[model samples]
Target: MPESATLPSATTKLEYLRKDLEDLRYYLDEFSAFLPL
Candidate 1:
């Protein structure tokens, strides 16, 4: 298999996952701030 045929898709998938994780972390941070210690 040639990387020219597969690299872009793999890179895009990773980028999408990273964005999702960032959003999830942001939401968790906000939610945790509202909780009492």
Candidate 2:
């Protein structure tokens, strides 16, 4: 169970998650200008 973070599946999943986060951030920034805050 140790060092399981190096698994190929986990790495790919992490990449996908990171990409999604970046996309979300970009969209948020794009729309934030129209927000009341």
Per-residue lDDT tens digits for candidate 1, residues 1-37, read 7988899999999999999999999999999999985
Q: Residue-wise lDDT of candidate 2 within 1-37, one digit each (tens)?
A: 6567568788999999999999999999999999988
Best by lDDT: 1
Residue 13 local lDDT, model 2: 92
How close to the true structure is residue 24 of candidate 2, measured as C-alpha lDDT? 100
Clashes of each: 0, 0
Question: Candidate 1 — which residues are off by over 4 angstroms?
Answer: none
Please report the candidate that would top TM-score against the real structure.
1
Give the Cα lDDT of each candidate.
Answer: 0.95, 0.92
Local lDDT at 19 for model 1: 100
